[model samples]
Every structure is written in structure tokens, then in C-alpha cells.
Target: MAFLAWSVCAHPHATGLLPETRLKFRPPPNSLFAVLLRSPWWVSLLIAAVLGLVAAALLPEAFRVVGALSGFPFIVIAAIAAQRQWRLPSAARVQQTQEAVSAMAWPAFQALLTDGLRRSGIEVQPAPAGDAVDFVMERQGLRTLVSARRWKSARLGVEPLRALQAARQADNTTADVPRAVCICLGGFSDTAADYARAHGITLWQASELALAMRGVTLPAPKPAR
Candidate 1:
């Protein structure tokens, strides 16, 4: 099965099929705090730890005891965060988390994305020429082009995503299908963000990947047009 899947993916030109029908969709309201919520949970605990340390250093004896008690849990949590950070893919090898996605063979890449989507409660289906745009995702009758790490430029611009949007339209299994691009390590140009927002393209960056993997509802971005 693995070999067969590879054979099919290795030659994208051979397999060309449209994704499912799409529905008009919107991401949930997002705030800085909401974005932070999806971030590594450790960040919050670390903030708490810093506050506790400040208390321990400055509070009087009677109050100091309260500070110490408040701080203990945060200290422990910080230690846990350190351990988890250690387990993440090496930044050296993984120039960007998206790099891993780009580096993997087609079968492996598709599998990883599919698993992540399943974990996030999104439905994934194999499509022809999946590698060209990585695969397709569907939820509530909505289809999206799901991809990661395909950009070569340092700052992502609007062209690439626009092309995908064009492809989606050309296929036209449905007109409302959206494009969801993962910007795991790089930043986007203001124009890129504006283009994505105007086109209703969904983007996932940094800790937001955690939210995406969990299929967390996204907040609509409204970059100045």
C-alpha cells in the first residue's frame, strides 16, 4: 500500500481530481489571549512562575509564605515545560516545523498531515495529484487545500496562495472551497496577510499550529487591504 501510494504521488500530473463541495465558513472570534491559549501551555505557567519568583524576592515574611505557596505549582510546571521543549524536533534539523513537512516523502507527509487533521477532528480524503497542493480537508461540506512548508521565499507573498486559489477554482468541484496554509516558521508580508484575509484563506502560524492540529476554530484575520 505504501509503495502504491508513493507511485501515485510521485507523478502528480497523472492524478488530477477535484476536492469536494465547499460551504461558506468563518473562523471563530480570536484575541491575543485566544491565540495564546493554543500556544504551548507552558508559556502561561512560565509567566506565573516569574510572578511567583518576584513575590518570593520582595514580600515580607508573613506574606512571603503566601508567595512561596503560590509559586510552588508554577515552578513545577516550568520544569515540565522544559522537558517538553526538549522533546520537540531539533530546531537545527527542523529549520522550521514546516521544513519537516517539506522534507518528508510524499507518503509520510500525507500521513502526518492526515493524522494531525484527524486529531483535530477534520475529515481528510485522498485526492489525485495530492502532492501538488498537499491534500484536501473537509468539514461541514466545506473543502480546503491543506498544505505546509511549500514556500521557498523568506517572506511569503500572495502569489503562491493565489495560485492555489486559482487551482481550486479551476477544478470547481465546488466554488467556495478555501485554502488553509500553514506558516510554521516564517513570517508573511502585510500584503500576503491582507490577501489571505480578503480571500478568506486560513493561515496557521507558530503555536497556532497546535490550535489547527486540534481543529480549533480559527479567528478571521483582517489585515488592512
Candidate 2:
């Protein structure tokens, strides 16, 4: 049965009759209507309306004839304009978005930490610093400093952690040694994680940072259901 089916399918006559046809449809020369409508949504709509009216006045059947004749030409024009105008702004938008996201590192870090700690029932107040100290947590009317470091790479060495410890030690007394939390975009190195754990500093990475932000606003007490 398999051999019979293969022989029938492989037959030259059967294959010749089932020829593939690629269809190509080209619009008419007078496609101004299509062209006018091919711009940004607002621009194309405005242009199409004006052009449609002008075309109707210049043609015999007013609306119907002019619209039918206008579709192809306008489509071509709009396609060209859309390709040029729409794509031109895309590169700029991408660049602007990149700049915006890059600027967000500090804010994202602050928000992430503030949200995370607050979720953990800790109230945090952000202190002004140059890309450092996202917030200082105030519990029981006493402030405990919490710093966030948003590193680009995951492999942050002990130097940063040591420096942070030193800074915290210098800034506050031994009694007020603020627990330093390093928030890294990428995952931390094994050594970094070990150092953080040994030093008693909370090291949050990736999605954990996002969760902390969401934790800040907890649900109010529900009525007895």
C-alpha cells in the first residue's frame, strides 16, 4: 500500500497537472487616494478626505467614480509615505526609550527596595544621594539606613560590598551600622552571595526586586466574611 501510494504521488503526469501559480496584483496608475491614506493615522485620514473631495469634483460620477478610481493610486502613495514617515520616527523612539530606561536604573532601584522592604513591613524613606542609598528605613522612630546598588553585571566583587560597609560604618556609629542591601540587575556571583550572607546584608536580585515594590501597598483589613 505504501509503495503504491508513493508511485502514484511520484508520477510525472500527476505532478505536471498540479502546477504552482504565484499571483501578482498591481494597482492602477491614478492611486492618489491610496497614497494619501498611507501616512500616520491622523495625517492620512485628513489628507484622504481632502483629496477624495477634490477627486470627486474633478471626475464625472462625483463620489462613486472618483472613489473607485482613487483607491489604487492612494494606496500606493500611502504605502510609500507610511514606510518613510512611520519608520523614520521609530529609530528616534527606540533611542529615546533606551535613554529613558537607562535613567530608570536609580529610580527602579529605589522603588524596588522601598517596595520590597515595605512589603516586609518596614517603612522606608528615600534619602538624596548620587546614585546611592535608595532609602533609609524608619522603624520605631529610629532610622536604619538601607542602601541599594544597581550593578549592570552580576559579578560584583567584594570591593563594592566592603566599600559600602566602610561607608555605612563611617556615616553611622557602630550601634547604627545600617544593614546594606545590594540590588543587582543580574544575578550575583557565588562569592558575592556568600559575602553578603556572611556580612548579614540582604542581597536581592532580579524579580525579587520587582516583588518588593509591589509589597509596599498591602491590602487593608477585610470585613469578617
Candidate 3:
């Protein structure tokens, strides 16, 4: 149970450890994989058990063992789904976290973002001078640049994201293509979101930020000057 909770918390996005260079693959909406992934983890387990029992009872005695083995596939699927669905925060908690983040000053928000990334098992470091992004995050030998300095902006446009995308392309120090992420409190303009999708850049808007900071303690919001 503990490990499953950690798995969900560690990979807040569907891409898991992979960079957001492409859309994450998803099963069809009505498919078994989709149903299992969205349902409670125990539902898959229950199905497995019921299938084994029914198969065993319906089959001849000589083939009873073989019939019970039919549920093995579901058992495997159940374990995978459990790791993703367990210990997810309630909607209310997500809302509360977003509210807290919205009220934070840049310094406080930057600290919160760093702490949250660390908890997700990503090594965070200050971005090099003149980089458009504010931080560089590394995991599994791949680097991802993160820009959050304008997180408090009322509306993010394509210009800032375009700068990050250019920075990502220019960073040739590593073999792997560096990914980029842009964070904002009020969300991005339609054009900005489209630009990000085209360039494979990840955008951390209100909900994404809330999920990432789930269990981390948020700094107190600074008073206005």
C-alpha cells in the first residue's frame, strides 16, 4: 500500500518518468484497460478472484487448475492499475492547494515548486545564466527545463513559452533532447496552449500545480507591499 501511494505521488503525470515530448498513450475510453485504470484498484482484484473461482467451478476436475490460471492476466493488470489509483487526493484538497498557490509571492511559490519537484524524485538545480527557464530538473539521465518566474501572471501568452522552446532547442550539451515546462497560476492563453502542444512542452496550470504539491507543505503567502 505504501509503495503504491508513492508511485502515484511520484509520477503526477501519465507520462511517468518520460519527458513530455509527445502525448502519453491512453487506452480507448470503453476498453478494459481504460475502465480498470479509472475504477478503484480493488475492482480489478475482485474481478480476478471471481473469474478464477467461476472458471475453476465450471471446468472439469482435470482442467480445474488450468482454468484458474485464466485470471493471471487480470492479476497483473490489477497491480498496475493499483499503483496509479491508490492514495489520490480528494478534489477538495486539490482546490485548497491551488488556492494556496495562487496567493503566494514569487519567492514563496518558487520554494514550493522546488520542494514539490524534489519530492517527485527529480533533482532540481538553478538554471544557468541567461536561460529563459528558472530551473533545471533531471531524472533518469534526462533534463527538463522549468520556467515559473511568471507563475503569478494573469494570463500567459505564446511569447514566454516560445522563448522556453527556443532555449530547449539551443541546449545541446546533452544527447537527449531537453524538455521544457512552463508554470502559471491563471492558466495559458489558447494560443499559448496550442504552441506548447505543438512543441511538446508541458504546462503546469492550476490543477497540475495542485497535484504536484499534494503532500508538500506550502509556504505562507506574503503580504502585499
Best by TM-score: 3
> Which segments of candidate 1 are over 4 A away from where they belong?
1-109, 127-132, 149-153, 182-184, 214-225
What candidate 3 gets wrong by more than 4 Å, as runs, is 1-31, 153-155, 219-225
lDDT (Cα, 0-100) at 160 in candidate 1 = 69
Clashes of each: 1, 15, 0
Task: Give lDDT tens digits, candidate 3, residues 84-123.
Answer: 5554556766677777877877888888877877777878
TM-score of each model, in listed order: 0.45, 0.39, 0.74
Every candidate's lDDT: 0.51, 0.48, 0.74
Give lDDT tens digits, candidate 1, residues 135-217: 67776566667555453345777766776666566656675545455343366778878987776666655443433333322
Q: Which ten-residue region of model 1 has the weakest summed lDDT?
A: 7-16
Better of 1 and 3 by TM-score: 3
When sorted by lDDT, best at the front, the candidate numbers are 3, 1, 2
lDDT of 2: 0.48
Ranking by TM-score: 3, 1, 2
